[model samples]
Target: MNWKIWKKKNDHKKKKTKTREWVDAIVFAVVAATIIRVFFIEAYTIPSGSMEKSLLIGDFLFVSKVNYGARIPMTPLAFPFAHHTMPLTGTKAYWDGIQWKYHRLPGLSEIKRNDVVVFNLPVGDTVALENQEPSYYNLIRQSDWKTVNSQYTITSRPVDKRENIIKRCIGIPGDVVSMKSGIMSINGKIDPLKNTGQMPYKIKLTTGNVNFEVFSNLGFKVSEMQQLDGETYLANATSEMIQKLKPLDFVKSVELYVESPSTNDGDLFPLDPKRKWNVDNFGPVKIPAKGWTVKIDSNTMPLYYRAIRTYEGNKVEQKAGAWYINDKVATNYTFKMNYYWMMGDNRHNSTDSRYWGFVPEDHVVGKALFIWMSFDSEGSFLHKIRWGRLFRGIH
Candidate 1:
């Protein structure tokens, strides 16, 4: 063979066009950003006052996936940036045809109590597209199932596609959690994290001519305080704020508003007549952990039926006064996954585990790191940005 023949047929390569170069750069950027979001860290914005004070509405923070491990997407096929629904189009952003098993990467540390976490709403599996705020279950509970179904378009979401909510993990796996008089107790002891949270207090003032400025100075928002009547008001305040308020002469008394256990809050978790648990007085229920077993009985069925039948994917039924799971006459259940109890720092205002029950392990997203930016919507133009909260580490 001639030596010239061995030479490259085309040594001169064609240069990329300006349009081609821009397209290539855009594609690379999207892929890199998606990878970073999926396996590293992701940005989240606080949309509600549920986590007030600890995490206020308009607070933008970064959630660290590596802290509690990043979950591999169960619904792998989806639009790059959109979550669940596509923007403007009002259509699905994901294809659930190719669903994958839940899997998580190795994490730096296991989730701990009081660690602020982002998790998928456990009750968000089924949703009425028209009314999603109260949740589909709540809608049915509020009215008849037929009425809800006839009025709104009903849809079901996979574990990963459900709505994401941020809250403090108050009860870890196997912890017996309960709330008495709005005071949460873990394993019969008062919650150590209670001080970090705030609740609605009935404030009896000496005069109706309240100095709203004084309360505002103690970090109370005008919107957060409601005047019930003359000389009485309901205010959401923290323990520290309550301490400071006690010294003020105008404050006759500031009493914590605890719901009586006897009062049947129709919206309470489990929704069982036997369990009259309310937000202020909830379970001594044990959180399910992987490999943990519990005796299946009438007493426990109401509390755990959802976990076994819904979250864990088991066919459960009761016949002849005996329980059957997956067509087997079973008297006990060994959980396949761990579960957690999450509650907002804004204890009285939040619809959390007290309303929906345990958050399964697969629902966990990540730990909130810090506030990168916080916006005050009602602030004056010059003071709009909450400068003090910028880059503040979340406790």
Candidate 2:
């Protein structure tokens, strides 16, 4: 009825509308950014030396999500009570059509060798990390880190007790990788291990027990060892030893050895075992393939239960001790996840695929596109920046 009052009311309505528009804009931006992260690129940081030379410690990288084709949102599961269900009718049978189908992504090709990749650790979870199998503890403890920097403080995340390592791919599925000295090989082809001579010395194994080495490379040592039968096989050895040993012989069982790793402060990582040599000393072994399923027996069972089946699916037979697919016993899937054998260019000092077996297929998350940024998890963020590695491409 009153013109002045009508005009005031209209102005109030316009203010409310503007507020809603701003809220909508903010929400839209957040959702759009999340979508891009889920289906496109993801950022990751390198925290360990396992992938040294290729990816330095503290180097941050952008991982391409679409490279391997994104796994369709199987219910788009998220943290906490979020899960897929019948949304409209309030039903729970939301995703019953094949339990989330996996498309091979026809347009996207499979992984190739020498491609730097990010993958989950071979273990599904760190469940096995609890057990202190001498070898298991050695592998974890020997990594160049500590639970606490000095005392009382948690140096890094406990769940990340094991390193989320970055390494260069040295082998792929169906490829026979061989290494000698610092050299590497695939399918009988050799990748010469360069003697960078930059490694340190720390411990040696005169007996089965780990002890400090008196000197450098001169001492007979087997660093980072695994038990084979009664004797201690070198965790690292030279290729000459692999070539010298007969099939299934002691030499075949023996691993490589180095002088030690305590040149500066051995506590940084595990002291070098008496065995300085590594895969280089051993004959080239064929990393198992996907179709080549094997019976879950004593020999193949450990690898099957752990490395193979941990990430993907496989049929297991009990007692008969055979595990395989399509009823084909005694072999493993050769190329389930496009295997990668990673190694640090610093051969003598690096622990890589030569110690651990082949990396699986599904475990691969993405390729390291470039180093966008870096920070020392233990040091001041600005001071610890590795400037030279910034903007560097991963080979």
Candidate 3:
């Protein structure tokens, strides 16, 4: 071979080798990241103020997938780092051509009540909008059903591919959950987390100007307060904060502000006017446990209908007012999976299980471990870092 030709060939081989090395490194990095995310832990940032004092907006957390068992990927074929949508392009990151059944590896502990948990949104399986802004469930109810149905495209998502939501798990499997005038009761007992959760309170001022300064001074969100009347203001506050307000000289009364249950809000689960359950006054309904069976009838079917058909993967219908499951005329439903009730710490502002129904076991992602880093977007550079919130353990 000519000397020049041989020298050119050697140069090309070196360039090819370098390209192969770079490709190998890229592949390794992607694989390692995906493994870490799926099995050990993954990072999540608080996008909204739903968790407020417990978890602030801009707080970045390291969620532990192993705490309640790492869920095996149901929709495994996807872009490595993205959750559901491909960043920038706004397209689906996953391909659902091949899907797997729900499975989880044994974990450190079971999900207990009041544990701040991260799970896939229950009503997120079907979305009418691309971004799914306020939440599909709320959007549909708030808008004219026929208008929305005709105007927007509806997309379906698999269990794992749905949007992720973080909230405090208030009810576990088989536990009866109810909210009496903004107070959560589990299995006939008031939730012990009264001091931690936030709810709207009517603060009636007896005398003097509204001391709005006191709210900010006490670390309460001033934006959450709304002036209802001259002396009366509605504020979303924690039980501890309500105690502080009650003792104030200018404050005449501090009472929990509950919406009238008689007013049929179609936004609530079941969407049946007869249920008469509102956000502040909700269920005594039981969370379904694995293998738990319930006798279904016209009265009970409305509550568990979504769970039976959507979550548990059963075809259910009513013929001549008699319920049928999986084409069989059945009066009883044996739950195939466990279910949980999740609610935001900031109750009035959150769209959670109260609006949608129970969260199925298959949708459980992981338990929120702690804040690794926190940023305050509303603050200046020097004050941006929430130093106190950094590395704080999540309850």
Candidate 4:
């Protein structure tokens, strides 16, 4: 045997073996990450100020799947890291080749009211193509919906594939929830508002220079301010700040700028013209729990219609003043899944349960545990890190 020839062959084999080992390691890492994400916990970023002071923009969170029980993957064939779409490519990251039915792994506790939660956006079922000015829904409402539908690919996504949104659960299963003049009451009791709950206030200023520092010092985000006249201005404010501003020397009078119920918005859930429920003054509607039965009629239809048809996955219809569930003539319908009412802590600015109705149990992702990191996009380098917010527990 030639020792030199044997040495060359041995060295070549070692190189190939090393390459295969590297590939194996990479595959293993990806698989482990996917499992942890689907069953344990996942990272999320606050993309908007919907939750505002409670959960701010630029705050990064570690959501715990174990809080409300980890939802079994309804859309399991997705890309390893991506949730819905591939980055940059703007294509569906998940494959519909295999989809599992709704199931949840047991968790430490049930979802309680006021828990900051992450779930799929129920109304994001449709989206527009390129060249929409403001929003896809806004563009659809401008003119004939049929024309807009023709141009865009309207996709009805599964419970899990829809966009992920985080909000505070204001009303849980079996709770009667309502908002009265921007104040939330649940089950006939004034549900204590979160520290960050906010609404718009119309302020009448006396003959004096407006103090911007006073609003900031009093802990108001002060989203927008428009001077209507020399003395009056409309601005957004937190509940506490609104009270604080009312007694201020510069402020003559302060009142909530409530939206009229008659003013119809296309974005409201149920999309019914008869129900004059506005964001500021919305329902005393009951949240549906599993096995709960309710009598159905014209009055109740608008409330639970979407819950039965879309959320619970049933075909409901009304004929000759009678209600039917799944093609069966019936007076009452039983809910198949637990439903929640979620609202942004920043009440005035949030697109939440007030607009889109209940969030189905299957759509529940996790409880927001902590803000691991925080950044301020609008702040300079020294001010970028929100020092007080880092590693803070989400209330």
Give the best candidate by lDDT.
1
lDDT of 3 by residue, 1-395 (tens): 56775465557564557889999999999999999999999999899988866888899999999999999999989999999899999999999999999999999999898889999988746767655555555654554111244455656798898888899999999999998777789999998554667788888898647668887786677876788988888887888888777887888988878877565566687665567888888888889999999998767776787788767767776678777777889979899899999989989889988888788888888999889999998889799998998899988
The top-ranked prediction according to TM-score is 1
Off by over 4 Å in 3: 1-18, 127-155, 208-211
Better of 1 and 3 by TM-score: 1
Q: Please give the ranking of all candidate structures by lDDT, highest first, separated by commas.
A: 1, 3, 4, 2
Query: How well does each candidate superpose onto the true structure, as a TM-score?
Result: 0.92, 0.55, 0.87, 0.86
Residue-wise C-alpha lDDT for candidate 1, range 1-395, written one tens digit per residue: 68877778675567889999999999999999999999899999999988877888889999999998999999999999898999999899999999999999999999999999999988746867774555678664553211133567766888898888999999999999988888889999998446657898899999988778999898887775788888888988889988999889898988987788787797777777767878788788899999999999878877788888778888777778888888999999999999999999998889898888889989999999999999999889999999999999998
* TM-score-superior candidate, 2 or 4: 4
Candidate 2 local Cα displacement, residue 183, angstroms: 2.9
Candidate 3, lDDT over the whole model: 0.82
Q: What does candidate 2's lDDT look like per residue over 1-395, in tens digits?
A: 66776566557664557889999998898778767765677788766554544455678899776776654543343322212233455444333333443333332656676667666554322322223333333433353111212222112112111234555676766677665553456787765543321222222233543232421132223344345534344333333333333242222233344422322323211122432334334435556666665444444443334344334554434335344454576454443544556666546556666555567654555666788987766557577876776787766
Query: Worst ten-residue run, lDDT, model 4?
Result: 140-149
**Full-model lDDT for every candidate:** 0.86, 0.49, 0.82, 0.80
True-structure RMSD for candidate 2 = 13.9
lDDT of model 3, residue 117: 92
